[model samples]
Target chain A: MKNTDKSAATARPAPGSCSPGPFSNAKGPDHRGQAFTRPGSGQCMKRNSILDAAARTFCRDGFTGTSIDLIAAEAGVSRQTIYNHYRDKEMLFGAVVDEIIGRMNAVLYGILATFPEKPDNLEADLVLFATRLGKNCMCNQDGEFLRKLIQAEGERYPELFAIWRENGPARVWSAIAARLARLAHCGALDIDDPDLAARQFMALINTDLQFCGMLGEKPTEKQIEDGARNGVRTFLRAFASRGNPSTKADPAVKPNMALF
Target chain B: MKNTDKSAATARPAPGSCSPGPFSNAKGPDHRGQAFTRPGSGQCMKRNSILDAAARTFCRDGFTGTSIDLIAAEAGVSRQTIYNHYRDKEMLFGAVVDEIIGRMNAVLYGILATFPEKPDNLEADLVLFATRLGKNCMCNQDGEFLRKLIQAEGERYPELFAIWRENGPARVWSAIAARLARLAHCGALDIDDPDLAARQFMALINTDLQFCGMLGEKPTEKQIEDGARNGVRTFLRAFASRGNPSTKADPAVKPNMALF
Candidate 1:
């Protein structure tokens, strides 16, 4: 599976920045078994640097516009080394996409772990959870790049898209929904279809940020916060249990916008 | 302006299918004045035929991956004819982008006019409106292509993205918000920020449909309807006036999913 490599990160790889666990020629998840593992930490770091630079160049210039030379210059490495690591730009892009998808997957679960099973402050907790998902997962530089590349190259490369199909947003939505189901069991929210509720929750959060994402601009921390805060509020208005659905609650009163 | 060319289509251009209106070599809105217009309806159709084929090919292949020879074969025109209209692949790609963006714009306004100004059946009216918006504007072939191109080319083509900045979803959100405001004015709904409500409305409806979009799959009509119906329901749950916020209504009880 494409996600098989995420386990190699010995460090609790930070949510948004999942380091390339082990470099591989695994173009698609279907052939992941054939991927040869890299040796040595020095080589691992070097591979990560190349992947990072490739991600940046690809996001900026597009798959066609990007070059091994461009990535090599950005990574401060020789083009031959890049070729030695990844056979071509397509292989490199597949690897880059795999890395980001893994990072975003980590980001999703990391935030999900903090979901409020029991909550005294439902709005605050939900907003915080949504904000972390937005900032660390959706609005981050890698998130921006992943989205850009996905929109740009959806038709041409299915193998490159293996990460999403195998370990993608569908899983993220269901994961979040499972948590919402747990919350619903606790009588914290009124939800009939946890799956639909989960999708809507994400949709609400993404509403405001979609424009910046479309234009390939990174939203300010403020914009991400506002989107999450407002989106979560809308989510609550629809799903919160009776007596808790305070539609008129002041948005400014919630001062806690911290990591969950 | 990129939107300025959309006006040339005097045939009451249908939403989500704006024709080239008039072909011009306008690479970006900045140099629109330099664009030489194609002469005569015959040539206009030929140019549009080439654009249509190019759009398909570009979506199928990335900008660099696509060749003039491939587009000529698809359009059934000589390669020289393709060059006769657009100077290069970049110019051709820009024209294709312009056509789709224009179509999406038409789609947006066409659906916006259907918004429930004053509704006797608010739920039915809003759901129908949202469904049409989803089906006609968002999930159609052109809409899918527009999103893919936007996400794919956000960084490399700022001038090519002039349609969005000059006339884009920002307006769509505000325009939808204005309709919601009118509904609120009539006490058919309860909305505080029309802009936020409009955005959330869009976000909610898109929740279910985002998956197909990500994978570049064209959602079935049923999928589009389900998304819009469920999304509008969630929207109503949050914003429907206190007397009208019926979250438990049967999903199948409503039979009408028609145009506004």
Candidate 2:
């Protein structure tokens, strides 16, 4: 919002996207039930392509602002082709959100399984877990897209998005809490309330990256790593077992942390 | 995005706004230089009515959606009357943002000043400080509006939002960092890298309230207080000096924290 609009419109660098290296969601792909379709099926591919385009467009523009014509152009299909798969614009949008939500939840649970139930190294393992979350679930295409759509359109379509937040993130937080409870059960950490600790852990991880995301900039892998490391370190300081020498705090020592 | 308009439309709840209580600015009002205007100036009041209308409309319907006609209607003024004060829509938007940004920054610093320089009771003092931040800065009208505008339109007008971010939040974070540094220096907390600690502190304060805000729900005073208490308790657990008995962690004690 400015007067005169003097900005010499320079090209904005497309935000970075990092494919997770060490983390893999190997729990069978296509959580949205497209898995049954044979890869060679033309119909399945066409459906997937339309959904992808819809997702991209909806994310860039709010639901009201997006049109079926825009989605068809984006998918490189005729508007008639789009109509063939989905009944109408509303249906198309639902399919996009549903597909991404399914994929997002699947990826989350997949990564949750990677949580170190028995960590040989507490600090490193926690950092690694946080990194996996950032790279795979939070910073990934589905995560970013859903977040944008919700923030932009939640007020307009509250109930529609309500399904999303409840089914996905609401349960997701509880799931994360359960995992922390497991850690506390084994005396790896000293968390009092697993739910509260879980929430803090999540918030801490975002502390380093929240600003960049709010500005629509994708974080680099280095940033994801640095953020993970810093967040995990603080988390350990807060909840690590006092008896555990590995994570024992030495307030005087400012150790240079590197994520391998 | 969803399919089939089968769901009956429901009117959206207009989001709540809280006038921050127990934390008055008190340091001469109107950070946007409206303080200099003599009270009851028709021109100044008219200008502000237009700005308030513009801010409300722009936030509700993003920059592209908002028009001079809409703002004029919202302000109860003739379109020409709005133009008389500001050059155009762009100019009006700028004035609205600038006024809010200035007010936001001032509120932030004013709250920051209340950070306990010497706390006889560390936990209580920190909770009080965090509550002040939440009520006065984050969840208030100016704070919520600017955040919505930035998120909705930052990409379209990257340069415009960039100034708000850099001037308001960037400096605000470092300013928070300085406060934490002072706290650490006084031996109340054990922190390395005040900047990192500062960011964590901000993130922690946001933890309990983030989800509600994302869903476009305004947090109640109770929620803000609960959030501050939970966040401060964790912050102390991570950084409070071991000698500080009030905030010292007890691995077995999951005390029900209460905020005064």
Candidate 3:
């Protein structure tokens, strides 16, 4: 199962080909004499590849069924290489969980940052925000992998999930809630509980997508757009401050009125 | 593994006894002349016990990990008895899915029937309705079982989940949509899309509970009530018609005003 070239193994750098050594500056030449751009970067690339392979394997096979060998094969690395990075299967799984959670949190916060801090049009801006959220956070590979992992293994590893909850949903919700509170403070919304509103906001955005995801189907762009549009409309209707006359009145009556 | 005849099992009839036969009225004796009340009820009793055991095992172990023997052991029935009813493990899983879906559908429709046709106080009525929905449909055993099954095995058995989608969410959404449409027609709500409203309605109610459920923790009655109360308030805010004088103004401002 070892794929490292025999010649390359003999000519390995002092740090070892798969070892993540801080001083490894130049990725030593492979058996084919192809030199990697940097020393440490090659090891980082291999580590990332292993994580990607592990995520796919875990999502597909679940925790109990996934074997380290399967992941090694999928990553095109030797089992020893994987063990060199992660001590065991459980440790690898934990790393995978951390990688996924960290990536999702980054993506979620990135999307949250774009949430109309100063919107010219509340409904339109919200729709755009929600759509980006759907595409960047929910419909993406990281989102799908993390969701499947949580569903498949949440019960088996409660401590891991507790950390996930803290870093994932809890933090995301608070960040969004802060944004909503800012909007409400600006007299754009009348939300009483920014936290609850944030939760409801996500829930509404996911209404259609959640059902599709449950059946293991990725939602289409059109479906995502429609869900966002409808969700934002209802959300605006519910929270738009009475002082914002353009949105305070039912948008259904004057649908074209822009609320800047 | 068979504990069907320990003193604990015999004394378990009040809640644990698996007997479901109508004729086995007394639940008194076993075939050893322990005076089981009646005849013919044993078959029905055995069937229900098997289903209950199957649901629990399937939800806990997932589809691939679960086996007929595990279910049989859990149900305290022989493997032959299980085969007598279910042709195989897949068939038994199908039966469990069917049983859960049927029971949940019945309960959902029963609660749907209690939706206020013409509410004098829309917010209060909706809170009560939402609370009942959370309690009877979502937090119950059948709902939990169905959710876990759908999440764990929906991808492997697409056809099963397709049917589930049609019979479960689709039907439920349409039913709630019809109710919302009726309220809109009565000028109590300004809903443009009853379908979207219905989806959002359920989504909001499940926000907190969904988070807890993901972490494998059951939400308390207080949590459920809070979710429902908050969800209904937001729902009403979004949909209550401008012409409905009682709800046209912000309810928070006049918190004590009784629209009823």
The lDDT, on a scale of 0 to 1, for candidate 3 is 0.69
For candidate 3, lDDT tens digit of each residue in A146-199?
A: 777776778778777677667776676778889899989888888877877888
Supply DockQ values for each candidate.
Answer: 0.46, 0.34, 0.42
Clashing pairs in 1: A152-B152, B16-B107
Instruction: Point to the candidate with the largest DockQ.
Output: 1
Candidate 2 local distance difference test against the native: 0.69
Instruction: State the fraction of real interface contacts model 3 keeps.
Output: 0.65
Pull out the clashing pairs in model 3.
Answer: A25-A39, A27-A39, A120-A260, B12-B17, B20-B45, B21-B41, B21-B45, B29-B34, B29-B35, B29-B36
Worst 10 residues of 2 chain A by lDDT: A10-19
C-alpha displacement of A217 in model 2, angstroms?
2.7
Which segments of candidate 1 are over 4 A away from where they belong? Answer: A1-44, A245-248, A252-260, B1-42, B245-248, B252-260
